[model samples]
Target: MKFLGALDDVSLGRTQRCNRRLTDPNRLQAIRDTGLMDTPREEAFDRLAHLAAELLHVPLTIISLVDANKQFFKADFGLPSPFSETRELPIDASLCRYTLEGESIISSNALADPFLKFHPSTGPWGIVAIIVLPLINPEGHVLGTFCCIEPKVREWTAQELKVMRELTASIMTEINLRNQITKLKTEQNLRDTFVAALTHDLRTPLTASKLSLQLLGRRHPDMPSVQTSVARVNQSLDRAERMIQNLLDASQIQAGKHVALKLSECDLHAITVQTLEELTAVYTDRFVLKAEGTFQLMADPIGLRRIVENLASNAAKYGAPGTPIEVVLGRSGAQVTLQVKNQGNPILGEDLKNIFEPFHRSRSATESAEKGWGLGLPLVRGFAEAHGGRASVTSSAEEGTCFTITLPLDARARAQTRLELLTSDRVAPASDVSVSTRE
Candidate 1:
C-alpha cells in the first residue's frame, strides 16, 4: 500500500535515462498493442475516471497513456478546454510521464516541486497537489498513470491512496483485457483471410471443369451414356462450386466486410424463377412460385440469384417431404419484397436467436447431417444487406417459417452513398494520426 514511499531518482529497466525510456520502442509498441492511445474515449474508461475523481474528491482525474512524444487521455473527468479538445499534451507538459519511471507519485506541494512548479498545471491551469499511480502492465512496462489533481494542496489520506491503487489496478486490467481482445480479433481475421483465399483458389479449377463438361456434352450429342455421366459430373461440380462461394462469402461478411457485387439492371422475377428451376434438379417438383409480375430493379443479377438459391435450398432442407416451398416477389413504393416460405417444423426459439449468423446451424439441422446449408442463411442475409436491403425470418407451429427480404428499387444510389461515406472516413490527413482511429 505504501507504493508512494519514494518519489526520486529511478533506473528505467533498460533505456538508461528517463526521457529516453519514455520513448522506448518496445514500450511504444506495447502501448499501440493496447490501442487505448489516440482512440476515442470509451464510456468504460470515462466511468472509471469519474469514480476516481469523486472518491478521491479531486477536481481533475485523467486516465492517461504516455506515447512517444505525448500523453494521450483515454478518459478525463475535468480536463480544461483546448486540452479537452486535443486529448493530448506534449511529453514535457505531462506529469504522467514522470510516473512511468516506475513508481506512484504524491506531490503534496506542486508549487515547491521542481517538476510540477514548471508545468502549466501548477500555473494558469490552477492545479497544485497531485497524486499519480503508474499504470504498469503484467510485462512490468509502465504505460502511463491514473492521475488525480487538486486546486489546493491537501493532506494525503491512507484511505484515498489505497482507493487510488485499487482503481489503477482495475485500469491496468482493462487495458490488458482490451489488448488481448484485439490480438484475438487479429488472429480471427488472419484465419478468415486464409479461408477466403483457399476458397477462391478452389473455384479456379472448379470453373475449368465446368467449362470442360459443357464442351463435352455439346460435342457428343449422339451418345446418351456420355451425356448422362457428363451431366452428373457437371451437377456435382456446380454444387462444389456453390459451396466454395458460400465459404468465401461467409468468410468475408463474418469479418464485417461486404461481398463484392456487380450491380446492374436485373429482372428479379427472372432470377427467382431461374434459380428455382435449377434447384428442382435436386429438390424435385417442390418449389412453388406465388407471384405474377415483371419486378425489375437495379441489382446484382448474380447476387439476386444467390439470394433465391440459398432461401429455396434452405426451405427444401427443412420442409416436410413433398411439401411445396413458396416463393413470392413483389414491389411496394420504391422497394421490392421477396419472400421464401416453407411448411416445416417451427424453428425452435433458441435456434431463431442466431439462425442467420454465419456458420450457425440449428441442433436439429446438425442432427440431420445435411451439408452446404450451413452457410446458406448467412449468405442470404449478407447478399441482402450488401444491396442496401434487409433479411428477416419468422417461424411458428401454425404459420410455418418464412424468410423475407426488402430492397430499394435502385440500389445504385444507396451503394454510392455508402461508398462515399466509407471513403470519406478513411481520408484522414497524415499529420492527424488519431483522426482515422477516432472514426
Candidate 2:
C-alpha cells in the first residue's frame, strides 16, 4: 500500500483555482439534465454505496454530484448525524471536488496533507483517507464522483482502485437505465389514455349512425321522416369525424407538438346559437341559450364550435333530468366569457382539485350507467388554452355547477402568449369538468 500524500501544501488560492477549474459548463449541464440532484434516495443507488463501503472495508461511501456551489449526496452509507441527514456540503468543504479534476483520486492519509487537513470532513467527521472515481456518461461528461471514506489512516491498493472503477461504471449504468425506464413508462401511459378516449368517443357516434341507418332501411323512401333520419345519420358521421380529429390533436399535444389554429373573425354568439340548435335536435328542449353584449371574436371557428359542443354535451349528460342546462355567452371589456351551467350531483372536494386533469373522471361518472373515456373536458380546455384563454369550473349544491371559459377578443395575441408559455415549460396543458344539484 503506497502512501501518496496528494493535496499537500494546497493554499486557499490554489483551492479556489481548483474549484474554478473543475466547474465545467457542459459537465454541470449534463448533471442537471439527469434530474437527479437532491432527489430522494433510491435503493439502486444506495445498494452500490453499501457494496463499495463493505467491499473496500471503509466506514463510509457516497454517490455524490458537484453542483454550482455544493456537493449533493444521491446516496451514502455510514455517514453520521447532521452530515448524513443533510446529505450535502459546501463545495469548498468537500474532497469530492478533486475527483472532478481527474479521472480518479487516492488519498492514503488525508489528515496528514496540509490542505486536506483543513477540510470540514477531515477534522469534524474524522475522515482520514478516501478513494474517489468520477462517474462519466457516454457523452464523456463527468457527472459526479463515487467515493469510499475511511475514519482511520489507510492506503488503497492497485487492485482496490480497479474494483472501485468497475463499481463506478455500474452506478452510472443504473442511473441511465432508471431514467430510460421512467420515460418509457410515461410514454406508455399517454398512449393508453389516448386509445381509451378514442375508443369511447368513437363508439357513441358510430352507434348512433349505425342505428340511424338501420331505421332508415325500414322507412319509406318518399316519406319526409326518411329525410330526417338521413340527416341524423349524416350529423353522427360528422361528429365521429370531428372526434377523430380531436384524438389526433391529443396525440400531437402529448408529443409536445403545437396545435395549429384556423384563425378568422367570427360571431361567437352565432356559433353558440347554432350549437344550441344542434343540441336541441339531438336532446330536445333540455338546454337554454343566453347571449349578451358583443359576442364577436377573432378565433378558430372550428375550435370554438368544438369547445361549445363539448361543454353543452357534458352539461346535458350530467345534469339532473328535467332541469334545463344554461349556455351563456357574454363580452366584457377585452374578454369574452362562455358559461355552461347544469344541475346534478355536486363534485367531491378531492375530485374538484384534479377535475380538469386528462383522463380524470369524477366519482359520479365512474358510478353512473353512462360510459365515457373522460376526454371531452380535456379537449374543451385544450381548445380554450390554445386560443390563449382558460377554462375553469365551480360546483356546489346551491349554484349547481358551472364551467366558464374566458378568452381574449383577439386570440392571435393570446395564441402568441400561449406559445411562449408552452415553450418555457415544455409540458402539455391539462383540462377538467363538473356539475351539481340543488339541495
Candidate 1 wrongly placed segments (more than 4 Å): 1-32, 35-130, 138-142, 148-153, 157-185, 211-221, 427-439
List the global CA lDDT of all models. 0.80, 0.78
lDDT of residue 263 for candidate 1 = 71
Weakest ten-residue segment in model 2 by summed lDDT:
430-439
Query: What tens digits encode model 2's per-residue C-alpha lDDT throughout 1-439?
Result: 0112344444554555546646678878878878899899989899989998888888889899887788899999997778788989887676777656554666888776675666665667677787878887777776789988887878889888888888998999987886687777688678858766777777786777777686775676777777776876777677777767667666555554556676778889999889888888777898888887777778888889989998998888777877999998888899999999999898768788777666678998888877776777877888888787899999998899999999988877766665566667765452111112222
Alpha-carbon TM-score of each model against the true structure: 0.70, 0.55
Q: RMSD (Cα, Å) of candidate 2?
A: 14.6
Residue 374 alpha-carbon offset, candidate 2, angstroms: 0.3
Q: For model 2, what is the alpha-carbon lDDT of residue 352? A: 84
Best by TM-score: 1
